[model samples]
Target: GESVGLHLPTLSVQEGDNSIINCAYSNSASDYFIWYKQESGKGPQFIIDIRSNMDKRQGQRVTVLLNKTVKHLSLQIAATQPGDSAVYFCAETPGGGGNKLTFGTGTQLKVEL
Candidate 1:
């Protein structure tokens, strides 16, 4: 049985500081990973993604890191802002089949002024 979970339920960071959200997946076969951000009433928005073949991928203001050795994934946000306040989720597709995505419980990101 494969499952995904977050290390922390909530993460608070000061505005302009860097924020790191961590997730652990039980499926070592999972090859694709995605990070999503969901606001108050909006659907989860794609933030960044990485593949097992790569150790790290960077997007506009975010970065996704994959550690296959430890079956760990992480999302990092640079210059955290109030707008970045939201629930962040990490998802992974088992075996890279892209058939389904198993999402974590999600971590609340709070950006303090």
Candidate 2:
């Protein structure tokens, strides 16, 4: 019951600024994790991921922090840009599945000039 959706379709931001999108996931039994970014109406692109065994994982310009104790997760974007505007989603694959994912709440991001 942790699934959430964006209230607004757009989030206007400057050309250069930090952006943080929020997501809520269900199923505490989920173990694997994944973060994806969708530009416009396109399919989501893989950003970063971490497993329940670890608390955090870092990517080129992204960092994912997970708190298994609270079943919470967050993504940190270092910088903001026009191309960075998109919807971000955090997903999980429960322990019983083989590379299957259950998506979580998604937050839309809009960058303004």
Candidate 3:
């Protein structure tokens, strides 16, 4: 058996407030990044993704921002609700033909009423 999530960061937000999650990657050559959200007893679900060539990408109620020079990525959720409570993380893949992806430490998001 493998340990998927032994350690995680945490974010607390009100039901109607927006939530911002931040992640930092170490791979300078990495060219692809994705954000995943996992609910209790569920697998990681794809939230959004951005490529190194892009600075920002937006989705339905969600946005992913990438800063390549600083290796920083952020997920912004608009009007976060209780249903948004979950664990979130970011994954980055290396450049060229590399298929390996590095995942950041998970973050637990708690929605308060």
Of the candidates shown, which would achieve the greatest TM-score relative to the real structure? 1
What is every candidate's alpha-carbon RMSD to the true fold?
1.0, 2.5, 3.9
Winner on lDDT (1 vs 3): 1
lDDT ranking from best to worst?
1, 3, 2
Off by over 4 Å in 1: 96-98
lDDT of the candidates, in the order given: 0.93, 0.75, 0.85
Worst 10 residues of 3 by lDDT: 1-10
Residue 40 Cα positional deviation in candidate 2, in Å, after optimal superposition: 1.6
Enumerate clash totals for all models, in the order shown: 0, 0, 0
**Candidate 1 on 17-85: residue-level lDDT in tens?**
999999999998888889999999999998888888999999888988888888889999999999999
When 1 and 2 are scored with lDDT, the better candidate is 1
| TM-score, per-candidate, Cα-based | 0.96, 0.81, 0.90
Q: List the residue pairs that clash in candidate 3.
A: none
Top-lDDT structure, candidate number: 1
Q: Give candidate 2 regions above 4 Å deviation.
A: 1-12
Better of 2 and 3 by TM-score: 3
Tens digits of lDDT, candidate 2, 15-46: 66766555555568878888899887699999
As a TM-score, model 3 comes out at 0.90
